[model samples]
Target: MVAEGAVFTTDRTVPIGAIDRWCSALLDELAGVERELWLVVAVTLVVDVWLTHVGLQHGLQEGNPVMRAAIETFGFAVLGLTKVAALGLAGVTRRLLSDRRGVVVPLGIALPWAGAVVVNATLLLRL
Candidate 1:
């Protein structure tokens, strides 16, 4: 049927398979990022352990309450928790990156590590 000056519309839905493929690609990318993050977490844990050992040996006081407690109690447990937290944060960053809204996530991940490096450097200098 046709009418003069009438507008027509057609269905334009995306295919389910296409959607599935897109999701798979995103998951694959996230998995790659997660693996890289695991390496970063491993390095961070090593640095954390070394810093904690040096800090304890030098009687350094931690500013963070939880870290202070961990430093005072079980340093290895704290290193384990640091790895868990890094992985958890990497998951969150992956989700944010998937959504293309993760401009600050990398910075957030690096800031603490940079701070630790600075503290470690100072500790080394003091030695």
Candidate 2:
């Protein structure tokens, strides 16, 4: 339960502006470079999955052993789960590091996916 003075509480006496201010502040925190990095991560995830699918159809395969097992068991839907896990990892990173360093979390995730995209495209070309 929140204290009586809490910005967000069940107390109906609290003005609407308080809630708006609280939400605005949270959105403010979410704005900036870190937000852009998260966008990069999101784009790469979708591209990676699409490229992975195309590669599989063209005789290439998942290079990562763990992901291979996952795909074998759960199929392509595993990519969606992994994407959620990646975002969870980014959230954890955001908590642990400052904004500057936290950008690394998404960068780390994006780079490998981008690299895989390159490799997948190359292989597909060869086929």
Candidate 3:
């Protein structure tokens, strides 16, 4: 729907390059935020798993089956929260792709591997 002359125009004056640069800067900021979210997820998962393991060990030592079950349940709940966060990210990514503002392509391109790393780190921590 863009006219030929308007294709590279912004503000009826600024060139498309300006828009590109602005978008790039915005994406860079978003990337940093995404990295932090992934880190939070990773750390939370690790802590959950470690706590679970410690709880299990204590339960076994004390011969308390109920306490072992309770700890495992709590640990799984934490892991489940991470999954929820991942799903939320996926939804946001999808919305970004469909956005008319045209920011999605860069974000989508930058997000997958980072998200995967978070998930893998979390799962590995549990083991």
**In model 1, how large is the Cα lDDT of residue 2?**
64
Worst 10 residues of 2 by lDDT: 25-34
Better of 1 and 2 by TM-score: 2
Encode model 3's per-residue lDDT on 30-91: one tens digit a residue: 65566555455455545444544454454422123654465466744544454456657755
**Cα misplacement distance, residue 120 of candidate 3 (Å):** 22
Global lDDT of each candidate: 0.65, 0.77, 0.52
Candidate 2 colliding pairs? none
lDDT (Cα, tens digit) per residue for candidate 2, span 55-121 = 8777677898999899989998897688788779778977898754455676678787788778877
The TM-score, computed over Cα atoms with residue i paired to residue i, of candidate 1 is: 0.52
Top-down TM-score ranking: 2, 1, 3
Q: Please, what is the TM-score per model?
A: 0.52, 0.66, 0.28
lDDT per residue as tens, model 1, 60-107: 766568777875688646755765787587667757675433433544
lDDT of 3 at 81: 59
Candidate 1 regions exceeding 4 Å error are: 1-42, 96-99
Q: Which ten residues in a row have the lowest lDDT in candidate 1?
A: 98-107
- Candidate RMSDs in Å, in order, are 12.3, 14.9, 14.8
